[model samples]
Target: MIARLARQLGKEERDLQVLEAVLEHQPIGITRIARETDIDEHKARYSLRMLENDGLIEPTPDGAVATDDVEERVREINDGLDDLIDQMESLKDLDG
Candidate 1:
């Protein structure tokens, strides 16, 4: 379960990297995002698609851009991650 969680965290980190790239460089393409994030094109594309499906981003003729609600969503995600960290810390206490 820990390994699965780690994998999930890694994927989320990658997705966040892609999102950051798009947020920083609006009207950005997959190629540029992949280059900037140091992720492969396929991963970048998948992340973009996931973001779009989540309503955090949209596709434009020029490229991809973040949605107005992106900041709010990011805040919520951060808060959730913080909660997860607390829970994980509690779990670590089990080893004691």
Candidate 2:
């Protein structure tokens, strides 16, 4: 069960990385975003499009910029991750 949850979260982290890269470096290009995040262009584009569709990012004349809601979502994702980590650490001493 923990392994399955970890796999899910690993995917979420990738999406979050794409979001963060766009928010920080935009007006930023996909190639550059790929380099910054160490993700391939294909993955970068996929994330960009998803975020745009979700209203988390905008493709401006400059580049893709994160919307206000994106930041809030990112914050929430981060906080939830912290809580998960704490739970895992606490459970380390327990027998499964």
Candidate 3:
């Protein structure tokens, strides 16, 4: 399960960063997410919309929250990333 997310995250680093930002700050607003993650607001908004479509996050009264599935997926992905960071970081800037 995590392997799949890791693979997807490798291809979608920006999306993963947005996800990571959301994971770090629940019920955070889009503007805050862009600032905290160092992502452009447009990109963050697009990512947020996509994440919602993917069922990774959902809207909250104050902002947004990661779905239970997303938290679990993130945990699994983190546990398996010991050796993959350097490789992924190298390609993080590439647009998918």
Sliding window of 10 residues with minimal summed lDDT for model 3: 74-83
Tens digit of lDDT per residue, candidate 2, span 2-96? 79988877766777788888877878878888999999899888888877887888888877888877767767767987998899899998986
The local lDDT score (0 to 100) that residue 80 gets in candidate 3 is 66
- Write out the backbone clash pairs for model 3: none
Model 2 misplaced stretches (Cα beyond 4 Å)? 1-7, 82-96
Candidate 1: tens digits of C-alpha lDDT, residues 1-96: 879988988888888999999999999999999889999999999999988998889999999999998999999989998999899899989964
lDDT of each: 0.92, 0.82, 0.82
User: How many residue pairs clash per model?
Assistant: 0, 0, 0
Q: Candidate 3 on 1-96: residue-level lDDT in tens?
A: 669977777546887888888888988888999899888899889889988887889999999899978867766767767557776787778887
Model 2 weakest lDDT span, ten residues long = 68-77
The candidate that wins on TM-score is 1
In model 1, residue pairs whose N, Cα or C atoms come closer than 3 Å (at least 3 residues apart or on different chains), thus clashing, are: none
- Candidate 1: regions farther than 4 A off: none
